[model samples]
Target: MKKIKYFYNTNTLRYEKLVTPLRVRLLRVFGFVSALLVSSALVIWVYTRFVPRPTDKVMEYRYNSMKENYATLKSEVKTLQDQIAQLEKRDNEVYRSIFEANPVPDSMRVKLIEKKKELDKVEALNDDQLSNEIANSLNNIAARISYQRTSYDGIEKLINNQEAKLSSIPAIQPLSNKDLTRIASGFGMRIHPIYGIPKMHNGLDFTAPQGTPIYATGDGTVTTAGVGNGTGNHVIINHGYGYETVYMHMVRIKVRDGQHVKRGEVIGWVGSTGASTGPHCHYEVHINGSPVDPVYFFYNDLNAEQYDRLLKLAATGSAKSFD
Candidate 1:
């Protein structure tokens, strides 16, 4: 059913059946639609402002997880750095110390200062940047580890050579002196038997019968095994490391020049040959061409009491030198 309403029209001065114009109806409908759209927009704005979307929730979770993982990675890197520092310290203080070698240079090690600066700002780094930074750090660590391994190899070689160096030292007597009564003349100023004047006795003289075997005091190559002016038939053994040993007044020269011999090997026999008064073996130790007391080199063959007694005998030996 349709209902119609009448409006009082003052211009017509009477109540009549009201007729609404199409423009007025259209205006009223437009206003109502505009209001409804504004209200809907306001409600949507409020919901979006206060609520989180599914994508936002997922992104937030991922970000938090990334932070936790980055922190763990940083901690692991720090642990590796600490371990490397300890290794460097030990290399300088222990291994290098024992071998008497220099420490590895800083250039051989990782440049941690620059890398540490970048890692300190890990929070500011993106995923790609963080990955690259960690990769660089790991590469540096690997290189440093390789350098340390090479250093250890060098130290091992030095250890091997150390044995040869020990054997090459002159550390024995030139002849058997188990009875501790063989030193005829000690090293110092003594009266020369032939000259009858005071002369520098640079070697120890061991009085023995003719043809008594004389031994080489160390492992070395014989540099001279012939007659010397005042030394008679002597042998000069060139032990390496600034050391040399001489055996003079030999009745028989058993070793020739350029022959390599070991310690305690027979190189000659005792005799009074040149500028000598009696049958004896003259033994000398030279360090860098300077003569030192031969009595000091007999530690390898003598015990405590025997060495002490020998020392006393050499110190208070015959004032006259054999050669």
Candidate 2:
């Protein structure tokens, strides 16, 4: 180290110092480096304490927000599921009522059963299931709705088909409020009174006195009402829905061809003009061009018990002529 002397001039406010050059330069450099280090340390400490870190509070807040969103989505899914169940129940009731009113086709019933099974599967799901489960339930509901729409389409098609077929066939009672005892012969294989051999009897014979009133069986147009030597004053009515009825052995025909007639409307008077044994009305029901027993036509007029009884009787009765 070098010895240094220093002097001060107080009047001029000036200071003077004498030292070795190398030692003074080293001390100055050391002081400058020390001050830089102190400043850097202070900056680092302030940043560490005052500013937010990269992966701490921000990440926690984001996690909580995600959880809240998931909860809200789950609740919405549950509400939608409940609504679907209610709609399915209502649809089932409507389908049941339709079945009670009219016979359900086999194909429609099968689809309904399939929908019910899908609904059952949806109902079995738990709330804790993932989003995929909710999506699956939504898909099933859409499929069921599609199936119901298809079922309605099928029913409409069936109705249209039936109506077309019924336009050609005859199935209705020929008269209303007339004495049922006037039926002298019935349908089935019977011995022809004239031929004395087995013959197919297509209609019932109502033996009424000449000039007894005859009525239409259902709403229809009279297709034909004229003389047929064998049937004797025949009238063919075309009722919609695969139904047609024939009225024969009439004394006077009141309805013309293509004339619309309602059920229970007088269309003629009973008489024996054809190959008749007496003055009677021969009524027949042809369903889709095939003859069914005329007794079945009266089914609509019977109550449930009476209809059942009639069915029982028909099931057990011996084959008899409905000539």
Candidate 3:
């Protein structure tokens, strides 16, 4: 059923049925729609402000997880950098000393300040940028490790060669003289038996029997195994590293012209050959073609007391040279 509303018509002072204007009805409907829309918008704004969506919660969890992971990764990177720094210090100070090489310069290593500045920008970086930064740091460290390994390889080679050099040096007496009694004439000026004048005796003369064995003083190849006008049946061994040894006035040469011989190997026998006056052996050590005192090279076989006694005997003035 439709209900009609009445209104007072003041002009006629009587009650009449009211007929609302089309404009007023339309305005009333517009007001209701506007109020409803405003209320709905306010409720939606409050709900979104106080409550999170499922996707938003998941995103928040992921972000927090990523931050924790980044912190852990940063700590690990710092530890690796510190370890590498320690390794570099050891490599420079300790390992380089083995081969007498100069240390690897600090300039060749990573620049800490530059790397720190790059890493400091991590807080502002996105996930991808941070990942790239970490990767780059790792690559730099790996490259340094590779370089250090190569340096160690070179040091190893140098050490091996140094060992060989030490082994090749002349370090023993030419003949066995444990009692220190065979030195007949020492180095320096002596009266020549044949010339009857003072002459430079370039080697030590050891008085031994005619068949006494003479030994090589070092590891080397025999370069001379024949006779000389003044040296008799002599043997010259060429030990590398600017060293050579000669055994002169031998009765018989046991080594060939190019035979390789070791220390203490018999290379000849003592004899009074050439200008020699008695059955003795003359031994000399040469460095780069010039003769040095062979007495100094006997360190490997002599102790302190024996060396001192031998030094005294070799320095004693003798009246004549055996050869």
Could you give the candidate ranking by TM-score, starting with the highest? 3, 1, 2
Off by over 4 Å in 1: 1-126
In order, the Cα lDDT scores of the candidates are 0.86, 0.71, 0.85
Point out the worst 10-residue segment of candidate 2 by lDDT: 314-323
Error of 2 at 85 (Å): 8.5
* Model 3 local distance difference test score: 0.85
Candidate 3, residues 75-99, lDDT tens digits: the string is 8778777877867676776566765
For model 1, state the Cα shift of residue 5 in Å. Answer: 29
Alpha-carbon deviation at 191 in model 3, angstroms: 1.8
TM-score, candidate 2, is: 0.53
**What are the candidates' C-alpha RMSDs?**
9.2, 9.6, 8.0
lDDT of 1 by residue, 1-323 (tens): 88988888899898889788999999999999999999999989987888888998988887897778678777867877786786677667656668688755576336677667666788788786776677676768768776886776677677666767678788888778789888989999999988899999999999889999999888899999999778899899999889999898898899998999998899999998877889999989999999999888788888888888988999999999888
Q: How big is the positional error of residue 120 in model 2, measured in Å on the Cα after superposition?
A: 19
- Return the top candidate by TM-score: 3
Candidate 2 error regions (>4 Å): 1-93, 98-140, 152-173, 176-180, 189-198, 240-242, 302-323
Model 2 Cα lDDT, one tens digit per residue, 14-69? 87784558989999999999999999999999987887678767777766866875
